[model samples]
Target: MSEVQKYTIADVASRNGRGGAPVWLIYKDSVYDVTSYIPEHPGGDVILEEAGKDCTKAFDDVDHSSDAVTVLKKYKIGEIVEEEKKYDANGKKKKRVVAAAPENSGNRSCMNKITCGLLG
Candidate 1:
């Protein structure tokens, strides 16, 4: 397969429709240059609400028609860099690793056990 073009989120953000810059937004992992479609958008300027950022949830929430989906594919310029993709190859959302809560000192645990026993 041909190597797919890759773009970082920053690259997509840089195209935000400010001044005369192009309007680009990410939907899932693919970046779409919607600048040309802006005027034709059936929803009018509402599309600009998500300029330069991921609009996966918003797009899906709208329950767009199959025609809209097809039109969206036409504007796809490239995929987001693999490291930055929110979904895996199979399109499942990646799990984020959250920092664990801090470990409590032994004193706190011991005090809590004793206090629990007394209250019982």
Candidate 2:
């Protein structure tokens, strides 16, 4: 089977502009969102230049583990995206992420199914 293609930071930035998609740059499996951290980037414009582009080399140069760059899932990034949605909101129409219920809330999956079934 063919490997699934992953996106570079540059590709994401170019696709939507500065903040575009809050993408997780997966080098090996662990995910990192360099979006919110862009301005504070130590590499300055070079890092920004690498924005939307793969920063594997940059990451390596900085000593980030290669194995920590995989398992990127868009759904796992509710926090940063929501924080970004708060200030400097962009895009034609904004999509909001629903926060996961707290731990004390019981049977989340069942509750979700029931709620969805009701809604449907």
Candidate 3:
């Protein structure tokens, strides 16, 4: 099989709404070109705010439906490079930091979670 394309964060950032290049963004380490879909986005121009940057948190915050995620597949472009990904001193991708919940709240969602690796 042919190799999948891999892009650096900088490579994707440079194409944001400039010239005629498509607006690309990263989500969960996967890169997508959403230029054409911008106008069709249900959330409207708000999506543009995340152009050229990692939109993982913003995307998850909205709790988008599975259908919305399926739609994103059509725009799939590539994956981010390893060196371009944020990593801890031990060389793993930085875990997402979430705030701790109140005591006795029965909530322990603040623990660190491993994100997709570079190839993923």
For model 3 the local lDDT of residue 73 reads 84
Model 2 TM-score (2 dp): 0.31
Candidate 3 residue lDDT tens string, 6-52 = 99988888877767767898887788999999999998878778889
The candidates, ranked best first by TM-score, are 1, 3, 2
The runs of at least 3 residues in candidate 1 whose Cα sits more than 4 Å from the true structure, single-residue gaps closed, are 98-120
lDDT of 1 by residue, 21-117 (tens): 8999898799999999999999998888899889889999999999999999999989999889998777678899799988867456777889989
> How many Å off is the CA of 76 in candidate 1?
0.6
List pairs with backbone clashes in candidate 1.
none
Report how far residue 15 has shifted in candidate 3, in Å. Answer: 1.7
What range of 10 consecutive residues in model 2 has the weakest lDDT sum?
78-87
Over the stretch 1-120, how does candidate 2's per-residue lDDT look in tens digits? 654444433344463225455534433222355565545545554545444434445666767443433322332232223323222333233446789867765555777989999999
The TM-score that candidate 3 achieves is 0.68
By summed lDDT, the worst window of 10 consecutive residues in model 1 runs over 102-111
